[model samples]
Target: MEFFYFLLIGAISGWLAGQLWKGSGFGLIGNIVAGIIGGIFGGWLASKLGIGGGGLLWQIVIAAGGAWILLFIISLFKK
Candidate 1:
């Protein structure tokens, strides 16, 4: 189903973002949650930046970028 595919990509994006930004992952459920929310944030941000596209690869890139931004913000508040 489309929903399942979305979740799958979200999870992968989150995990990838975590690994790239922090050298670790937030576990399965955490990754899924972060990915989905990040995907939403990423899409909004991309639209604002005049970036638009389709396909699984683009989705992952956007989601991961969003997740990285989210993580960076969180780290800032943690300090």
Candidate 2:
């Protein structure tokens, strides 16, 4: 289902973001939340920025990129 894909992409995006940033993850639930939020932001930003990519993989990539941005901000606050 579409919803399942959204969650899946979001989870993977969060995981990938965690991996991108060292010591930046709140665990599964945190990741999901971050990922979902990032996915929406990323998708919108990508469209606005005219970044071109296709398919589920592209979606995950963009979402993860956005997640990384958010996680970085959170890390800044935590420090």
Candidate 3:
């Protein structure tokens, strides 16, 4: 189903972002949430910028980028 795919993508993206960003990522649940939200943000941003997001790989890349951005913002607020 599409929902399952979304979740899968989100989980992978979140995990990857956490690893790349060198942050805790708020654990599995938080990572999932962040990734899902990141996916939406990335998709929207890409659309708004008139850029093609490509396929799954590109989706993951965008999602990870968005997730890292979210984490950075959160960290800034936490500090």
Clashing pairs in 3: none
What lDDT would candidate 3 get against the real structure?
0.83
lDDT of 1 by residue, 1-79 (tens): 9889878878888888888876864666776677888888998999999897898899899999888888777778868
lDDT tens per residue, model 2, 4-66: 989999999998887777755878778778898999989989999999688989999999988
After superposition, candidate 3 runs with Cα above 4 Å error: none
Give the alpha-carbon lDDT of every model.
0.82, 0.87, 0.83
Candidate 2 or 3, higher lDDT?
Answer: 2
**How many steric overlaps does candidate 1 have?**
0
Which wins on TM-score, candidate 1 or candidate 3? 3
Worst 10 residues of 3 by lDDT: 17-26
**lDDT by residue for model 3 over 1-79, one digit each (tens)?**
9999998998898888777766677787888788888878877887888986578999898888888888778779978
> Relative to the unseen true structure, what is the Cα RMSD of model 1?
1.5
**Candidate 1, residue 62: how far the Cα is off, in Å:** 0.4
